[model samples]
Target chain A: MDFSAVRSVAVLPFHDLVGDTRAADRVRDTYMGMLLATRAVYVLPSGEVNRGIARASIRNPQQPTTDEIVKLKKELGVDAVITGVLREYGKVRSGSAEANMISLSLQMSETQTGSTIWSGSSTKGGISLADRMLGTGGRPMNDVTVQVINDLLDQLFE
Target chain B: MICSTSCSNRFLLLPLALLVVLLLGGCAGLEHTTVSSSGNTDLPARLEEGALYALLPIENLSASRAPLAELDMQLRNALKERGIRLLEPERLETFMREQRMRSRGGINLTQSRALRDLGVAGVFITALETWREGEVPRVSLIMRLVQSGDEPEILWIDGVGRTGDEAPGLLGLGLVKDVRQLTAGALERLLDSFVAARSGAEPGTAAQKKRHQPKYRYRAADFDPAAEYRVAVIPFLNVDTREHAGRIVGLHVVRQLQRYGNLKVLEPGLVREALLSQRMIMQEGPSLEAAELLAAADVLGADLVVSGRVFAYEGDAGESKVDFSLQIFSGIEPQVIWTSHSYGGGDDGVYFFDRGRVPSAHELAGRLAEAAIGDFAQ
Candidate 1:
């Protein structure tokens, strides 16, 4: 893998299918780890992308369209826009939380052409620490996010 | 030889008599005989496995309609009789309260979590819709199945049973009877759809299905608790006539988020502080620059922002109802991580705040909180 070729990767806020704000945070948090792990890729801070999205006046930020994604990538001047969708999330029991069954669909495109070079999606589910203390049980949110991100990254890097 | 033959013949007679007596005794011990009764033998069991369901209090959405509460009770009982585990309305209400959540007009995350907790595979929400055709009476129903981890599928069943003139002609059937029949029909159809879906049959695939999935998790195993993230809860949009209803709902939700003691709750005060710091007015509705709000909260810098609205507050002359709709967005990109709507209803008909209904506002609040927490479970 040519690590030097990938630089300044931008992670767009993941789209929330259910519209719960917490799920979006979980996704961003999970993605942060992956970004940090990839030494070659310079990841843009999620906060910056969020601010840009908020400024864009888009409804349902978690589920933006391809066009909106293109516009965001251009505005941010990043190599790629990492987007995701929260497929399912919640605490099935009092403390046991299922954070994300993220359908992580990443589109790596030439920012100029808006043509997708690579796109892939993966479903992942996890439990939260609060859920564990509450005695509820499920997969951890981070685990799900990491797995989804890894799958997405593989598609993009490959 | 003659004596031996005579003895053997006596012994044979005694044994035959004994055998007859035993046979007669067995016959006498037999209870009532069951003759085959012919009926609807093919009728399926009322309750099926992996069927998620919701039992809603029937509401009269028509003029001069029958009380829906009674129908609600009856329908619940009927479903119970058929071996269905009816989602305890009281329990569901409690869970909602503990979570400090209110119902959005439709099935919210709280209900989904509660149902899932109850081991229900799906939910059946029943509502009454009534209208008049000239002087004749007409009644109908809108039933919806909120499947766990799937899209919301709705079914509308309608009809006219009897008019006032036809009512008298029938064998002592009244308005209640007519309404009950209509409800029974709606319930039957609801169950039919459930069974059909489980059996992998499509029931009106043309109808639009609304897919609702959760956005985030709160457990440590899911994410590092130490990982700092900024959550934004936008001012709830009110779909009701009540002023400040959105603020009330928003405050309650923010309080619940803080209670979780895990994720950092972006306080309304902080939102105000950030807005003021940015020299922007913290007013009604989502900020024109949502990104600014995200940045002010440091959400862009943090992890996620939560935002949504108070979509509806319905009440009659005596009772008050409140509904809140919410969504969590990624602070990085303001993506909605999760979404939920909760509702709270109370009877305020008689007593003032000091001596209100037996289930006082505090109790109602508690119930709403349970729902809020339970929604996460669902």
Candidate 2:
């Protein structure tokens, strides 16, 4: 697959399958940073696309179709679209710290071809300050999310 | 041989008719009946020692990618730790399978019947939304208690929690982490309210013992209608940007408190008058001096004063998002008797400006008010 041609990308608001506002925010920020790192690509604002998708009720789907994806791409005006699903959002109590975990899968598709070019997923865990304050080393949710986003971007950009 | 065959057919027909009559008689006997005894039997009134509750799988209303199972488990564990008896999930699963029940969805009536048949005193059901926004994970959970044999009476509690900005490390780490944190926090609040109602103790009571009595211990007749209890509702502060949100929320609190039917609800017009006479606007914060405010209607003699803050409101987008906390104070001295917080929202923003979305909020308020009244009666 020729990745160089995918210079202009549109980021969709990460759909929260888990409905956790915090996890959604983390994924959005991480994806924003990853897109920004790709200087060659022009990324559209996710909020605008999300608003349009929501207004049209196309973001929520039992099974999204190719035509729907293509339409969304045309409406949002982007050559490629980055979409992902949030799989999990939770915390585990370790020794003395609580380890928060978040998992996501990202899929990039070419609007014209209607074909998925790249797909990958990552899960990251972090410890909170409360856990560290209690002398327990735990990974915070934010740290793990950043790492996962970086890894996913490296795979796609490389 | 012809006569013998005819006789055999008659015999079979007679038996069939008899069987049909017996079946019809049995059906007729199943009519609703009530039993009354002239005198109360001295069969040692056994106090209900403890209640066993079964929490069914919570229906996921948000996106499908969320870890809903883990969140349900977390809530179950939180309730179990409070010394409340909970039915094991595996057992529940086996029982549900035996009953040919596949999903918790559309099982509201069936579930109530099953719990009653199982002889459980209470059943807990929940609905959850787990979603990610930006780098933060948000979880919205609504838990309710349906008493056995009580068709319409339900106690509801709703809560929302968010995880700090972070991502998942493993295949299901993020979902699990967010679910656990959010469910745990919600369970804590719910258990606290449940325990408080059961023991008639205020929050932070360490030595309270579980009361082994039925929920409806006090009847409406037990309250003295002649005794007028002065009640006041302070202006609920609005944390959200919605204008007049505080007044609307405050009115709701006042309405719920008045519904007790035992006490006279002070008119909203009179309350406004009292505030004006005191040179106080609704913009002012809650007042602790019940005596000063009572000059209009004997505030010092008030049995309870309800006050709270509106932390959020339904936006113009139709999302039913709202957060409010309430506290019931006893006497003019302002001693806290009971306190509760409720949060509600949805993704489509359709919950706001919609009466249907308000049901969840109303249920929570009713439960909280019931608890408050239970304390006063005790």
Q: Is the docking of candidate 2 incorrect, acceptable, medium or high quality?
A: incorrect
Candidate 1 positional error at B345, Å: 35
- Error (Å) of candidate 1 at residue B162 is 68
- TM-score per candidate: 0.28, 0.30
Ten residues in sequence with the least summed lDDT for candidate 1 chain B:
B31-40
**Candidate 1 lDDT by residue in tens digits, B1-378:** 999999999999998987665544333211111111111112133335635456655534433446667767876776675556666788756655774543322344445555567676655555443323333333334343344433221221111112222222223232233434544654564454444433444323111112111122231124333455555555555543355445444544443443332455443434543444566433223322454455543332335555445544433222334444454445444333344444444432323221223112212322343345334423
Q: Which residue runs does candidate 2 get wrong by more than 4 Å?
A: A1-158, B1-48, B98-110, B150-152, B156-183, B201-378
Candidate DockQ values, in order, are 0.03, 0.01
lDDT of each: 0.46, 0.51
The candidate that wins on lDDT is 2
Which stretches of model 1 miss by more than 4 angstroms?
A: A1-6, A18-21, A54-70, A90-103, A124-138, B1-275, B280-378
Q: What is candidate 1's local distance difference test score? A: 0.46
lDDT score at residue A17, model 2, on the 0-100 scale: 78
- What TM value does the first chain of each candidate achieve? 0.65, 0.78
